[model samples]
Target chain A: AQSVAQPEDQVNVAEGNPLTVKCTYSVSGNPYLFWYVQYPNRGLQFLLKYITGDNLVKGSYGFEAEFNKSQTSFHLKKPSALVSDSALYFCAGGTHTDKLIFGTGTRLQVFP
Target chain B: AAGVIQSPRHLIKEKRETATLKCYPIPRHDTVYWYQQGPGQDPQFLISFYEKMQSDKGSIPDRFSAQQFSDYHSELNMSSLELGDSALYFCASSLVQGANTIYFGEGSWLTVV
Candidate 1:
């Protein structure tokens, strides 16, 4: 079984300020991690994924995540946050496309 | 690019009633997945199919059943609807479900009352 944990229930960031949502994974072997964003009453939107290769993975809507194996973390980041970027962000884990185990989710609130 | 399509984006059903949700996967995609998202919660995997065959299962309830047609479209039949069944149902697809970027539909909002 694979699972991801979101340490924060909510993160507050002002518009134009940088933001981060923390995530950690528990997997037996090589881990495939993904980040998704969901607006109110909407489906999960793919932001980015880390399968293999570079530790820094870029995603949609100016979002990026750094995979730290030793730390067992994949933290979503943005150099500058926008009000529109506010949403519920999720961190998911899988080995190779198996059913992904998702974290509880972290709500990102960007105030203008 | 054609993405995963789901029918009846919003549905309202009474308790004990039955509802069916449809999903049209992206063209040439061989795998389809169903997920349920509760309010303010993460999406939970229900089931998945590959080449019209059941490939994986998750926390799907016995009252719900799903199948993929020969054309690769899929249907999810949920019976005996309960208040707990009210949630956003998402249908997602990928080429073959392995390390592929799985794309999700806008989602079907099912309201049980």
Candidate 2:
């Protein structure tokens, strides 16, 4: 079974400050981790993925995530948060069944 | 880069009525996946197809069926709609054996009345 967990239901950060949305996962085989963002009434947009190799992966919108195998975590990070970054974030782990199991989601709010 | 396309951005249906959603995958992509996201909920995988064949399924109701066509387009048919079925249906496509970074469409909003 493959499952993802976003411990925080919501995260608040000041614009220009750093932001981190935590994610952890459990999978039987090699984990294919991914981060997606969804805005109001919009479909999910892919941020980045950690299939293999590098632990630190950079994504669109100046966002990145670090895949920690030992910790079973893939936390999304941004050095300088923007108000436009406010949205719903989801972490997912791809399964052997060729489907992705997603976490509940974390709502990020970048305060100006 | 061409992205996945989904038809009927918004749909409304009554109970027991049937609804059909269509999806067109990106060019050269051989895999298509369907997911349902309820209000205030994470997206749930419903089904997937590879090369016009069913590859995997998850949590899809019996009343709901989907198929991928020869051209790699797909359709999801839902019968006996219920209020609980109201959600956003998303279609994603990816190249088989490639990076496997599934790209999602804008999604179709289904509201069962």
Candidate 3:
């Protein structure tokens, strides 16, 4: 079975500081990892994905993620956090069966 | 291009009542997916349809059902609503089969009273 785990329930960071939301995965086959963000009362917005490429992947809103196969981790990162960037972050792993298993989610709070 | 669209942005239903949510995928997309999101939790996959056929059913209860119409539209039907069923429902579309990026709709909020 494919599954994702987000270790942190919440991540607090100051605006203009770097932020990291941790994620790890377990899958039987080659893993397809994805990151999504959700604001209050809105649907999830896709951030980025690691299908098979370089270790570091860049995404929207100045966000990026590092895919570490050895650690089974794909942690989302932003060079400089913005207050508006506060939202819920989700990590997901896709299996060969096409099912996407999502982590419990991590709340990102960017304090001004 | 227009992204996925779902109808009835909000719904309120009593216990045992039936609620139906509708979705229209992008013009050329071939896959439609349904997901449920509870407060402070990650979105959970309910079901998915591809090529006008039911492709996958997730951990959702049997009271929840879904159908795809002509590859462009889909519907989610909940036979008997309960308090636990109150959540936000999302519809998404994708072009290919496995592990592809998906476009999402604004989402419908269901409140079972």
Candidate 4:
């Protein structure tokens, strides 16, 4: 079985400031990690994924995440935030047999 | 690029009524997945199909049944609908069962009164 965890229910940040949304996962075999963002009344949109290779992965909308193997964490980050970035973000990933499991989600509030 | 398409973007049904949601996966994609998302909650995996066959099951209720067609389209049938059945139903598709990216549809909102 595989699972994901996003400890924070909400993360607030001011525009132009750096922000981070943490995520952790547990998988039986190798992991495939992903981050998705959902706007109001919309389905999830793919942002980024980590299959292997580099520890740092960049995604759309100037977003990036680090895959920390030792820590078993994949935290989404942004250098400069924008108010338009406010939305619900989900962390999902797992093994081939287990399919994908989504985290509870974190509501990002970027204030302008 | 062509994306997954879903029908009946919004549906309203009475208690004990049945509802059917349709999904059209991206062209050439062979796998489809269904998920249910309640208000302010995360999306829960329901079921998935590969090559017109059931591949895996999750927390899907016995009242709900889904199948994939020859054209790679799928439908989810929900019976004995209750108020708790109200949620945003999402359909996702990928090239294979464990593809790296699974594109999702806009979702069908079901309101069971």
Q: After superposing candidate 1, which stretches have Cα over 4 Å from the reference?
A: B97-99
Cα miss at B1, model 1 (Å)? 1.7
lDDT of candidate 1 over B21-89, digit per residue (tens):
999999998999999999878889999998999989999999999999999999999999999999999
Instruction: Write down the lDDT of every candidate, Cα atoms only.
Output: 0.92, 0.94, 0.90, 0.93
Top-DockQ structure, candidate number: 2
Q: Candidate 4 has which clashing residue pairs, if any?
A: none
Model 3's CAPRI class is: medium
Q: Give native contacts recovered, as a fraction, per prediction.
A: 0.65, 0.86, 0.59, 0.59
**Candidate 1 lDDT over residue span A1-112, tens digit each:** 6789999999999999999999999987888889989888788889999989999999888889999999999999999999999899999887765767889999999999
How well is each residue in B3-83 modelled by candidate 4, as lDDT tens digits? 999989999999999999999999998889999999999999999998899999999999999999999999999999999
Every candidate's CA RMSD: 1.3, 1.0, 1.5, 1.2
Model 2 has a DockQ score of 0.77
Candidate 4: which stretches are off by over 4 Å? B97-99
Ranking by TM-score: 2, 4, 1, 3
Write one digit per residue (lDDT tens) for candidate 2, span A3-111.
8999999999999999999999998788888999999999889999998899999999999999999999999999999999999999988753378889999999999
Sorted by lDDT (best first), the order is 2, 4, 1, 3
* DockQ of candidate model 1: 0.74
lDDT for each residue of candidate 4 in A1-112, tens digit (9 for 90 to 100): 6789999999999999999999999976788899999999998999998887899999999999999988899999999999999999999987653457999999999998
The clash count for each model shown is 0, 0, 0, 0
Task: Give the alpha carbon lDDT tens digit for every residue of B3-51 in model 3.
Answer: 8899999999999999999999988888889999987778899999888
Question: In model 1 chain A, where is the ten-residue run with the lowest total lDDT?
Answer: A93-102
TM-score of model 2 (CA atoms): 0.98
